[model samples]
Target chain A: MTIDALEQRLTDLAFDRPDAGRVTARVLSLARKRRRRAVARLGALAAATLLIAAAVVYFVPAADAVLADTPIAGDLLRSAGLTGAGNRVTAVGAVASSSGFRLQLVGAYADSTRTVLLLRANPAILPLGPPSLDPQLSDQFGRTYHVQSELTDSRTGQVIIEFEALAWPDALTGARIALKVTTLKRACASAPFCTDPVSSEPMVRGSWTLRATVGVDESTPLALPAPAHLGPATFNFTSVRSSLATIGIEMSVKGATFDDLQQRVADGRKGTPVFTIDLFAPNGDTATASYSLGEDQRGPLIQFLGYRFGPGNYRLHISYRGSDVDRLLTVP
Target chain B: MEAALTLSDAATAALTPDELCRRYAPSVCRFAGMIAGSSSDADDLAQDALLRAVRAIHSYDPSKGSPEAWLWRIVVNAGRDSARRRERTRWIVERLAFTAPRESESVEAAVLARLRDADLHAQLRLLPHRDKTLLALRYGVGLDTAEVGAAVGLSTDSTGKAIRRALARLRARLEVTRP
Candidate 1:
């Protein structure tokens, strides 16, 4: 069956008119304390289910076997500042580390922190569209993340964030991030929806450029190709704390394309941006650097990251710059 | 001084609460019914929705369409809020037991009915829930810009912009899915 037809069928499932009943005393009763009680019961049930599952996992040998019992297995993910509530057996989130002096470290450079978060899928959830050859499935990862890039009042220090799940628990593997833009259209002025280039909407006109990057110890900074419009928008970042390790991530707009800007982005050549961030370990050895695109359009940029960390407190950071055809990289 | 039954109703034509409730009740009930599953919850949802409509009535713009469509908007918004709560509760449970309401019969019914009430509702649901609600009220419920703004708790101008954006998405989805 065609997808449009499939969508129609799915949409129809929610079309029933269930409220044929009159508001008699009985109906009122149903609306009364009953709904509140039902909702409360649902909440309680959710709590009870979680507690019981935790109990089972605690007592079952299989749980231990699947988790941390094996050599080079689940043990001391704690050292990398890793922890998890349950096996979450199947997960897809990326544990990112940054150079934020929030942990114990005998590391190389940049303050360091390591953190892991979990995200999962809702069985009823539907993707806005079909998956592509390299579809960005951030939502399905064991944890979902939110991204934000902020230029401090100083206009120098960028506090870019790769937010993990509300209560994520894991360790750093690499700095994973994603970006997407869709539903671009031209507004017809005369008719408000004229698709003709002559009549497309001005509001929808002009190409958009976006960029992000991370640098060590608040060192790297981007050379803005053009001026930017700043605002009071707050960047909220969520994370689940694990070991004493700390990880930091930073993002910023580097630049945009002018002619057919939207077209370039859709073509996937708006230039796959890069991340320049430093990684640190607790020990004084093995400090490293990483980027989003190793060289060119090599692979899927979603959560594909590089890393370096050692014993002790770890912190890391990512910095980037992107604009139309002009791509620039820097570290403060 | 006697209040005159003789007084022209228009001068004091504001509808009695009961009259207002009666007039818009069925559409609200229908909307809630489709959204909440069981006509039972729909009945309750409709009443609760009306109560909210009354409290927020001053915010309504007469320049918009008639009050009936506005009431349907209220019922839809109320039902959605209730569904989100239900989903969240289900989420907590699934996390613990690894079982969820999305697996249940009634929940499935609720999702289907809630999203397919009108041609536009079905179309919007295929896009995203946020887009669905935004468009269903603007076009399916046939609210004017001002009314749509009030219904969505957005500014009148913003409501139009939102509907436009949603329409763009709908077109894109259609284009991609075209055989």
Candidate 2:
């Protein structure tokens, strides 16, 4: 048969279309259940945090001295290792209100490899669950960035969203940043086990825009180790930069093009021969490569969140086609 | 109100839950049915995908593509996850000495009942999973090469080449099977 004929046949395959009204009702009903569950979980977490805070206050007085004015922001910055030197902080205090809610861009923190925006909501627009902010960000150089990770304090409606700056390492310094957010969603508590939002909880719609200029932080590049080989691929580690939120690794892969590697990764998801890279911390904890920014003549840049990787030696593990290689590396 | 909004219109406008269900539910159902190879499973897949889209709507940047493309990407990923889950279940069932029903067997039976091309359907099942997905997106869902690329995370040229290669492979297999 001709391929076109086969296509036509496939298109003609018969199946009964689901009833839209029934599916809608069922989805909305399930969404309500999910929202209620999220709220309950949030309540339990808040109670747990309060108890921990009380105990910490009573037992450890030194912790209070290190906390920023906003405890949530303080904790986030501290965990990200952004409170130390080589980090630049700018106070914007830009505010906007709409749809019965108020939003403020409190400030921004920039390091050599990442930019983090701190935002606060008055009257707590998001439900007592995980908050989802979809803000479109663009810099003066017209380069856009996506949110790499976000942490929200539901009780205070305080949020810290991070973006990778490795693509244009020098462009963020002293650049005007515009952020526009039109809707706020109550995101799923966790991925893969996620559920729909409550039908009653429509996405909060409003236009909130803020502008700020990022300060300069000198980029500090770490020394790279020797190339690691696996099967037919030679991985040359070109550059590694550590920031508060993530460690960016730029490497070139010889003997495999970007598309080939991407296809291999996709096939790996299907129980086939896999290709993966992982970074292990000194404490034996590990973080897998999260996402790729893009590729240039050098190679694709991969990033791993610096959550588990404190100041110590790390082990870089590469697995491909049943072959495994581990090499010791240090992140300064 | 549901009938008044086109898919593109829904993309630029604020998407309500009602609007989302009305504008895209049937298409999503059909697409999910193709991926799942079973109508019953397709309903569940469509529901899961829609639920995810609603919750992750904030991540949808219009500059990336149309809302339809964004939603279909979610559908494709959801289908892949479902397939992996089924594979795991099948592995467990086999270990326990239970006869697991093949997804293709259901597809063959359904095609025999609905269309006059059961042989072709059988051959299609023999193709790799990615090839089947590419075909389903391009032919079954009526997505163009660009939309297929957007959904599957490939460039337009790469998508076109992949689809052509998949078609050639399917044709060779069909010829070998034919009298």
Candidate 3:
């Protein structure tokens, strides 16, 4: 039997549809009963109990990396001045301390258009569950770098964040940058499987002011052939921008109007464009690159893979629903 | 006080419990029914799921998932809870009975009977609860990848990949059992 046949059989099992009206009535009745029960319980408790517990203060020594963990990439360590001869520190206020938690900026590495911040958080207060890291970097010139991705390893409490600095100036010799963090608590001893793991309450919040000097590694942009027209917009292959951690496509969108799209976006009515671009390796293996709206807010934004591809031929496929365009690119 | 009441009423009117039930009760019931196996159990489970969802609505964060996805998750969990509590669950028996045809079965039942057997049924039955719920929610209740992912605690990419893998395994098994 074919896969479609199996799917058909699976779908057919639900043919005898349950009664919506009956179910709804029963649900409403049950809900009303539960609400009444909850209210009655609350009323009974109001008349009976008073309990308080003394707050206790706990302290744990901060975990610091004396020698850079070799598990960290060499390029990252060097860029942050954590490694190499005549190590110059570019990180502003490298360590941020807060109630029951301390986050250290282990290193900061920048390429042509992106920056990666490797941070370690020590949740010394409560038993650590999964933790989330929110890192915000802004320069004195009122330019804020967009955090492209924030990846956290719960086991080690290490966070690797990649932010786009494409819109920043050519040189960041002595720019004062502020980094703010809002850490969320994911797991506690109780209710780990609850619907809202990281709710409104943050585990800890801290901000640091720092002076940063980015040593840029200039990357040559690759030229591409003429634009490929797909649906309403004309897709132009502009350049291949390579950073320390990612390989990306820099392209523009034109011909199709984004006036209405911009309006919807401004009104918070629309997000995440319908189009997607994927990169496929020569051997039929596919790797999907996370994309974001262009820094310039123009067309053909950034479609970048987290890591650089090995020396090989790859196909960049631009697709909208079913229709697509393929471009062969060779990584030198 | 009147203004506050009016605002509260307007908010309640926006997504009333009755409105939510009307919009999603059928799918919820169908999802429960598919997992529960019998009509009576499905009906009871659907009510229980909806009630649980409503009670937890105050805590429902839209940032986490859509309401429908959240409701389906409850149904899936409730179905599993029932299964664990009952030694010989009706759904387990129904799953085995579904494949083998009885005397003078209906036309649809006969069609299914021709396609499935005890061996194939056993393989399908042996699948993990999450896999079964994934298939049921995607096909039986007609939830999209994102919705199914939200319901089953998987990302969209993972959900799509899982469905493909499960389908491939089932197809391969069916091919092996083909007469």
Candidate 4:
């Protein structure tokens, strides 16, 4: 028989349709359960934040100082547990080593907002200069956790990489961290003052993975009440939070549709972000925020993970496409 | 409720989960049953797909794809999972029936003509899982090349070639069995 005959035969195969009302109810019920779980997770996160704030305020005036003073790797090895506020700090680390490099999961201590991983490479075998890695960390359900920043020490042959844990699923207290080293080149080529030969050899590639359990440290959120109207959309910054590794903005929008924000971009209106929340430190360094809209939008949430924010007051500049938004506020 | 009144199935990306299930459940169930090789599991697979779609609604940007295509992708994933579960069960049952004559042989004897006329169905069962899914979505569910490609994670050009190859392969199989 011909393809038409085959198509007709396949189409003739009968299957009894399920009850629409029952299936609809099941789907809605599942969606409701998912939302409830999310709210519960948010409640837990808020409680955790309050606990961290209390500990920071009452237990340690020099908490930031104490944590920052310890070597980045050392602090990861010995950070306080979340059993109680102001509990004695103890060292708990998740370490994974591969043939080429050793990875250490330091607590998210430099600031509580960012999770840090320390990579120690053999300097002799592969000269550690400016090496880049493709980092993939996911929960059991295949949701991705993103990295925010990478800091390297050429002298120590150690790289401290930080990732954003704000968007990670609640069920996953621990995540699978997969790091694929894309390039490991000689230091001479990348160092500021270099007279050594520039080697044209292919860069070294290696991979390592670890299951990183999140510790109970958190950064205090500062409310930044700045609202700006752009085109058909209104951008609102509800709060700002910082940790050792990341700076985040809780952003919401009003008076916008999928066509105006996402569809035009998908239809090739240029690479314009629906919302661009930029963080500017006092030192003039700035990091742009990135966001992902879940299928249901309760407004938009923009977070800048992996952007290194040190101890200082800062300003946040909000913009839409290329135009400036009116409500620029000093970050609390 | 206002949006429900205004938008067509092809127009709006923001169709409610209830609407989606009501509109597409029949075809989705048929597609699932074809891929699953049993109609008994089709309802369960369709329910699973709808559940997954509703849970992931936040990530569904209409700008990237149509809602129907998105639902098809979920149906394919759910159907594959169902097939795997059934395979495991069948394997266990086969091992347990080592002492008994195969009941499947007797069942086939009763439905011999139906199987022969439904040569496409028998031939589809013998194809690779991916090819079977591609064909099921195309001919069984009446999806176009682009929709089939979207559901199966293939490009339109590749999908076209794959359907042609699958049709040729099925034709060859039917020819080989013809008396």
Best by TM-score: 2
On the 0 to 100 scale, the lDDT of residue A125 in model 4 is 19
RMSD of each: 27.2, 22.8, 22.4, 21.8
Tens digits of lDDT, candidate 2, A233-310:
667777776654356666777656676555433333443435566665666555432435356786554443343235
- Clashing pairs in model 3, backbone N/Cα/C closer than 3 A: A92-A210, A253-A299
**Interface RMSD for candidates 1 onward, in order:** 16.7, 12.4, 16.3, 14.0
TM-score of each: 0.27, 0.42, 0.38, 0.34
Q: Write the per-residue lDDT of candidate 2 for residues B13-127, one digit (tens) a residue.
A: 7776666777777777767656664454555567777766765666767666788888889878877765654554355543453222232333333433444455665555455
Expressed as tens digits, the lDDT of each residue in A178-250 for candidate 4 is 4444445433333223323235542455554555444434556765654554444566666666544346666
| Residue B138 in model 2: lDDT | 86
- Residue A291 of model 1 has an lDDT of 22
Candidate 2 has an interface RMSD (Å) of 12.4
Q: Mind sharing the TM-score for model 4?
A: 0.34
Residue-level lDDT of model 1, residues A1-332, one tens digit each, is 23333244433434555333343222232222111111112224334433433344334313211122122123223322222222311133222222211111111111123222221111100111222211121322335333211100001111111222322222223223232323122111133222222253322212211212111121122232221111111111122122112333332222222121122122243333232334334342323311221112321121211122322333232222211011112121
Worst 10 residues of 3 chain A by lDDT: A51-60
Which ten-residue region of model 2 chain A has the weakest summed lDDT? A33-42
Which regions of candidate 2 fall more than 4 Å away from where they truly are? A1-70, A73-92, A123-133, A140-144, A153-155, A164-173, A186-201, A243-246, A263-273, A287-289, A293-310, B1-179
DockQ ranking, best first: 3, 4, 1, 2
Clashes of each: 69, 0, 2, 13
Q: Indicate which candidate wins on DockQ.
A: 3
